[model samples]
Target chain A: MRASSRTPLTTRLWAFGVWSVVIFFVLNLLGLIGSVVTSSFATRWLGTWFPAGFTWKWYFAAWDEFQLGDVLWVTFEVVGWVVVISGLLGVPAAYALARREFPGKRFVVLLLLLPLLVPSVTYGIPLATVLYKVGFGGSLVGVILANLVPTVPFVVLVMIPFIEQIDPRIESAARVFGANTFKVFVYVLVPILMPGVLAALLLVLVRTIAMFELTFLVAGPGSQTLVVALYYAVFAAGVRAVQSIDAMAVVYMVTTLIWLIIALRFVNPTQIVARAKRDTSH
Target chain B: MTDRGPTLTQRLRARGLDGVTLLVLPCVLAIIALFIYPFLYGLWLSFQPKDGTTMGNYDRFFREPFLYKTIWTTLKISIPVTILNLLLAVPIAFRVRLMKHQRLLTTILVLPITLGTVLVAEGMLFYFGPQGWFSRTVMALGLMDHAPSITHGYWGVFLSLLITGFPFTFLLTLSYVTGIEPALEQAAATLGAGPAARFREIFLPLLLPGLAITFCLSFVQAYSVLPSAILVGDPANTTRVISIAAYQAAFEDYDYSLASAIAMIMGAVQLVVVAAILGARTLVYRGPVAAAKG
Candidate 1:
């Protein structure tokens, strides 16, 4: 307060510096993505500020050449099953963990944390090994199961705080009215917990769709997700058009970005990370 | 008519293993069978002898300098990314938190995370390659006579890592920064603490622990770099991270034991860094609650 004379000068300088950084960051992001978008439609981009000409031919070529029809279908199937199964297993577990107290609770919480905290690749190799040994690794079932390792725990952790926020007295009131266990859960708990459930499932869907390491290991020709397919298009032996590969990358980006936007509507990404941190630090 | 005996469900409920506990059973079973079993199986596989009675895989990894160099390569990329990300994130988070339109800024920053590492890497090839706009612009600006190919070397991969890593590190730092009650800073200012004084006396001490935590988490993430390294960098070895080594060992070499051994070592290194950071975090002077109240 006493330094009012200096405040104006410092604030002006500070604002200038801050906006510079913001503009720089945004431009860098735009440049990288913009190049891909422009090239995907470019007839030719050699030594030009913009493409020589634009066309939608590359999109069609990419779709046909990459068999993205099957890949997209497989991606949907894997993401869908993973979302449903993770929810089915995770929501109930979150409820139990939230509403009830038991011995070894700390240990159980740590068990849940391990999958999330560690990198997926660390466990993915072994998981893939075991899956292949059992004749499941190269199929859709393997990809879904492998993804569930991290995602199910993600659902449980995200749902726990939501479940905990609800007052236990609501359930007790339902119980006192002679509603049985099943009735109390469905008629009373589900309505109140719907928001949390939706948030958990949506985030799980985004994560499964984007999950790379585990999915990469277990996925085969018939089971490749969009991400794995994109990897192959980039690295696998081939002399494909640069524009076509960029087109596929664009497809993957658009697919993931759409779900992420939807998920953000349900919950802030900050809250999800912060809550998980808080849960673990305990 | 008088069959009023307690049913099986009621009996189970009478014990603490009620419906709630049963709710937890599927998760527990799945974790054990899928997560725990596979991890243990991998560990066992890592020890299998090619001949009959030797720890051959572990020995091979240590004996082959090429295989062991991956640890250093992983650290080389991870440490710089971690440090640079923090340096960039802290200042940006401070400034961004002050903005009235933080939601928009956060969305702009977080958009890349949705585009996974693979897409980001693929985009880098087009954006940073020799004939790409970046190089063309540099040449046009007379910065160089020709467009130096940046996308096929260490710099290219590093640039991509920054693109992906910055957003994540920034998000974590933003949450931590925002969590600190603004009122505390205001109170310090009212007490005649100048800007520097307020930062040093009030903010720095509190932010240190949080910064350490962020560093550890971010480092763990960067340390696991895989796809970008392979796709963009000279995979003949320049950017071959441990994950890539492990992957090639298993798939290309068909040496399952060797791959498992590399993976285990990778986990060990990550755990060591994490533990050390956690220890340092606990040593700092901490308040009753570090996070800002919701």
Candidate 2:
């Protein structure tokens, strides 16, 4: 190697590796989004770098015909239940698991984490049959319950780490000062775990919004999600028949981006709890 | 009058009663009834006939080339997609660790988690269709004689997965990658190891468990893929994954037992693959002090 070429391979490696990756991301985003936007607006879909002509005909037609407004309402309904049910059930469980000294805690935690492995297809047929037998086979409530299987796990996993950061002494101090179990939980524990809970809530809500595979398999067609609707529009009536799916896609994308922004505001996302070593004196 | 707190044992007992049963039972039972029971039932249904116990479905799956092809086809599609998704995810995750403003980039990448598979499939139709963008761009640039039709088969499904599955793998791995301590790598660098050596030694060893987890999650996620399989993969040649076949059998053919059988096999395949990856991880750990210690 020429002595002059000795800019240090490590520096060269860092530049080649990290900087190139950022450029790759920029190019990819430019290509992918640039493509989607151009195609959406183009009267004639031909372009060297941009669409030949612009038109909002597809967007307007899609809005008028597809009832995207109604779909958005239902989307909120489903996501709302997903966040609320998962939060109420998941947060306390996370707290107990964090604080309690129990025999089967590790096993309990593992059991909670295991649902993620059972692929959506595995449950579709059986869940359909069982839900039918139970007569909740098609209700919005049924969808919410099925969605919770995944949502709760998500919350608990993120929450356990966050809840661990609170000192046990704070709760004991509240208890020693004439507070009860429920009162201590509400006043002390909940306040400290608020950021973590917010993280978990946003995570579940955002995920619920985009959840297609589970809802698609289990829900009736009339109860279609924006994603499922988008699929139908493209497959049943070629991409041209329903222009609204694109508008809906944009809505879905923007909603997700917003939720992601919310989640990123919290630093050290994984500290709910790690080791569970009990502080004996407290 | 001063009110005393409960006796130590009384407080402990109350905590136990309230905490264990109320907090844990519902989740446990839900999983057992919904997840575990259905798993066993599916396995039993896979083996049982509507009439009697029979290897008939299993025989049919193997004897027929079309049915057997679903297994190979599923592996072909899933394995490569899982690998590619991981490969792409690793570099980005590495960058995520090495850079400032990484949280911002991580959030942007994870934005795909907001849109479901259906939306992603729909997005692909807009982005990759003949008249969508790429083909039109090619036509405009005078690179092709006619618009290239890239949607509808292998490449279509591949591209669809490349976009959607990439994010899933990336995020799962980002959890692992960012979890790694930088001090370990810095220590290796100071000891005269190069970049590749530090990675092969310190970096890779620490991430063993995380990598295994991401790989399994990716495999399960890819295998469970249904919406995109239906929308983009042209059954003629492009894609015919096992899930697609099971969906067809249950709804199209109205053969619940056969559909159950296929699903059971598919689910088994998922568990076995995950178990295998986990096993491989254990073996990987046992093989090197670097990992066992790390």
List the DockQ of the predictions in order: 0.55, 0.40
lDDT of 1 at A115: 82
Candidate 1 interface CA RMSD, Å: 2.2
TM-score, cand. 1 vs. native: 0.93
- lDDT by residue (tens digit), candidate 1, B1-294: 898999888766565556677687798788888888888888898888465555887787788889889888888888898899998888788888888878877887777776878878888887777777777878888999987877867877788888888888888888888777789899998999887788788777878877887888788778888888889888777888899999998889878888888888888889998888778777876565544443
Poorly placed runs, candidate 2 (over 4 Å): A1-6, A9-22, A42-57, A239-242, A266-282, B1-21, B136-149, B287-294
- Model 2 complex DockQ against the native: 0.40
Query: Which stretches of model 1 miss by more than 4 angstroms?
Result: A1-15, A271-282, B1-17, B290-294
lDDT of 2 by residue, B70-168 (tens): 877788888899988888777777766666766556555554445556666766665666655566667778999796666677766766676667777
Cα deviation of A29, candidate 2, in Å: 4.1
Task: Sort candidate 1 into its docking category.
Answer: medium
**Candidate 2 lDDT (Cα, whole model)?**
0.69
Each prediction's TM-score versus the true structure: 0.93, 0.86
Worst 10 residues of 2 chain B by lDDT: B285-294
Candidate 2's displacement at residue A117, Å, is: 1.5
Per-residue lDDT over A1-282 for candidate 1, one digit per residue giving the tens place of the 0 to 100 score: 667666678776876887797687788788889888888999988766788999999999999999999999999999999999998999999998987776666777788888877778888998999999999988999999999998888888888877887889998999999999899989999999888889888878877887888999998889999999999889972589889998888898899889888888977776534454333231
Give a tens-digit lDDT track for model 2, residues A169-274: 9988998999998898789877888877886787677677777766766677556666666666667765454334565456566666676666557533222111
